[model samples]
Target: MTIDLPEYPFPQPTALEPPAEWAELRAKCPVAEVRLASGDQALVLTRYQDVRQVLSDPRFSRLLNADDAARVTANESGGVFGSEQAERTPVGEGHQRWRRLVGRYFTAKRMAAMQPRIQAMAEQLLDEMVAGGAPADLVSAYGFPLPVWVICDLLGVPDSDRVKFAYWSDHMLSLTRYRQDEINAAQLEFGEYIWAHIDAKRAEPGDDLISDLIVVADAEDGQLSQMELIGTAQGLLVAGHETTANMIGKMTAMLLADRDRWEQLLAEPALVRSAVEEALRFDANPGFGMPRYLTEEIEVSGTKLPPGTTVISSMAAANRDEEAFDNAGDMDLRRTPNPHLAFGAGPHSCIGQALARTELQTALNVLLNRLPGLRLDGSPEELPRREGLIIGGLERLMVRW
Candidate 1:
C-alpha cells in the first residue's frame, strides 16, 4: 500500500515551529513514502526512535544518497531509479585517521579556549548593532556576520575577504534561491578563490586552521592535496556558516516569541544555558535531517524497505515526537535529557558541534544580557522566511530595544 507523505519541509507559516503535518504523520503514519518536488519517491521516518535508529545505523549510507536517488527512470537499463555515482568514502583506519586529524581542531577544550574570542566577536557585533540604533535587521547585521567572522578567524581568512566567502557559501548551501547553473558557477568561483588563498597561505603559514592544514599537507603529500584543501575550505565555509548562524536567528526568534520566556531568561541569567538547549531543541535547524541511503534491506516500524532505498529523516519532527519527551511541543528551559537530534547522530553527526554550541550560547547570552529590553518588532509569522527546502531560518529578524 502506498501512503502519500507531505513533501519534505512542508510550507512552514513561520520558522519557529515545524509544519503541523509532521505531527499527523508521526501519529498515523510514522513511516511513509514521500513524493519530492524533484518527482522522486522516498521514505520519511518521523518518529523519534525510528529517526534515531536510521541515523545511528551504519548500514544507512550517506554516500549513496548524495544525489537525488529517488527519481525513477523509465529505461530498464538504468534500473528502477536514476542515481548519480556515489561519492567516495574513506574506509577503516583511513577514516579514523582522517577524523582524528581534523576532529582535534573542534574539541571542547579548543572551543573553551576560543570562548574569549567568540565572546569578543559577539560583543563587537552587538556593539555595532547598538550603534546602528533601533529597528535593525539583526539577521544580516549580526546573525550572519558573527559566524562568518568566527569561521574565517579559524581559517585565517582576512575580514576583507568575508563578503566573497559569504557569497560562495550562501550559494553552496542555498536550496531555493540559486538555480543549479548559478550554484555550479558559485562553486567554481569558490574553488578558485580557496585554491589561490591556500597557495598564498602555503608560502607563509600562520597560527590558524588553514595554516595547520597546510603544514599537514606538506608532510603527508597525497593525504591532503590541493583539491582536498579546496574542498575542506568549502565545507568549512558553507557548513560552518549557515546552520549555526541560522540557529542563532531561529533560536532568538523562538525565545522572544513569548515575552514571558524572554523576561524569565532575563530574570534568571543562570538559565542562559538551559535557554540555549531549549532553543536548539525548539528551533532545530534542518526541517529534515540530511538524507541517507539504505545499503541493506531494513524494516522501520514494520515498513519493510529494500536495499538502495532513499530515506529522509526529519530531526525537527523527531525532536517534537510526543513519545520523546514531556510537552515535546513546548520548549522547556530545564528539560533534562533533552536528547534532540539537532546535531544529528552517529559517525556522520556534525563535526563542528562543539564550536556551534559555543557560538549559539555566547550569541544568545550576549543578546539577553545586554539587550534586556530587546523584543520582536513584528510577528514572527509575518517575518520573511528563508526560501529553501534543506534549511529553514528567518530571512530577516527585525528587533528593537
Candidate 2:
C-alpha cells in the first residue's frame, strides 16, 4: 500500500507527543523517500532496526560532496553550522585522533564525578524559579541556562563570556533567521573567541578541557592544528549546551503536563533514569539524525538506494516503531532494556552521552523534589513547537507550583 508522506509545514513532534501521522508511515513503508526542505530527494529510515543499521554501517558515509551538501540545505549556500566542512574532516584517522584528544575530558568516569556539581547547579536554578513565583518561563529560568552553565564550567569557559557564546551557538544551530553572511560571520567570530581562550590557557594552564586539549596537541607532535583545536572546542560548546538544554525544557514540560506522571516520578524517584530515557525517545528534535550520502549503490531494508543518495535516519520514528517496542506511543517510565537511539549509534555515537544523562537525571530529580505540585501554567496545546527545522522543542514552557 502506497502512503503519501505529509509535506512541509508538517507538525513538529514534541517530547510528550509524536507526530500524529508517524504510525501510518511506519506501517506502510519504513524506508521511503522524503522531500527535504531543500526540495531534494532524501531517503528516510523510519524503522528501529533499519535506522540503527544505517547509522552504524560505515558503507553510508556522512561526508557529502560539495554539491549534495549545498542541496541538502534550502539556502542553496552552506548550512549555519559549517556542517559541510565538519563532514569533510577525514572520518578515519583524523576523526579518531580528534575524538581521542577530547575523550579524556568527556569520559564516563569524569561525568560520574560531576553529578554533585550538576545537582548543585540544578538546585540553584530551581531556587530562583521558586523565588520568581508561578507563571515563570522554565526555558529562560532553568532550561536554557542550566546546561550552558554546566558545560561552560566543565570546559573552563568564563561565565561572563557565556552570553556571547550563547549567541554564536544559537545562530550556528538555528535553522531560521540565518543567511550565508550571518553563518560565515558567526563561524569567524566563534573561531576567534576559541583561539583567544586557547591562548590564555597556554599562558596559564588550568585544570580544564581546553588546557587538556593543549597538552594532548603538544604531545601528539602537533597532530591537532590550531584550526582543529578551535573547531573542536566550538563543537563541544554547542553540542554540550544546546541539545541538553532543549531536552531539559521539553522533559520538564512533558512531566508537568501529565499530573499522574509527575506524581509518579515524585513518589518513586528511582524512575528518573527511565523517565529520562523516555524523554529522549519522545523529544523529536535532534536536528534530524546525522545525514549520510551513499558511497555506492546499496539496498537498505529492501529499498534500492543508488550511490550519492542522501539518507536521513529519523530517531523520532525509530523510537516509536511498534516492532521495536510494545505500545511504543505510550510513555512508560518502567520500560526496561530500552534501546532508543536518542543518541545516534556506532562510531559517531555521542561522546558526551554520560554527561547529558547526568544533567537530565539531576534536573528531573531536583525539579520533582522541590516542586511537588508543579503544573503547566498554560494549556499544552497553546505552547507552540519549533517547526520546519531540526531539534524539536517548545518555544517557551511556563509552569506553576
Predicted candidate 2 versus true structure: per-residue lDDT over 129-199, tens digit per residue: 88978889888889888988988898788866778866776566544557657766876898788889999
Q: Which tens-of-lDDT digit does each residue in 1-401 have in candidate 1?
A: 76565665577656665777788899999877787665577788889999889878876665433333211110000000001110123434544455666778989899999989999999999999999998998898888899889988998888677788667755655556677788778768877888888999999988889899888777845566555556566566666766666778887888878888888888888888778777777763353455678878988898888988988777777778889878998888878778877777765566677888888889988898789999899986677777753556678999999
Residue ranges of candidate 1 with Cα displaced over 4 Å: 1-5, 64-93
- Candidate 2 off by > 4 Å: 1-9, 13-15, 65-90
What's the C-alpha lDDT at position 20 in model 1? 75
Candidate 1 residue 265 Cα shift, in angstroms, is 1.0
TM-score of each: 0.90, 0.90
lDDT of predicted model 1: 0.71
Model 2 earns a TM-score of 0.90
lDDT values for all models: 0.71, 0.71
Q: Give the lowest summed-lDDT range of ten residues in model 1.
A: 74-83
Task: Tell me how far the alpha carbon of residue 186 in candidate 1 is from the true structure, in angstroms, after superposition.
Answer: 0.9
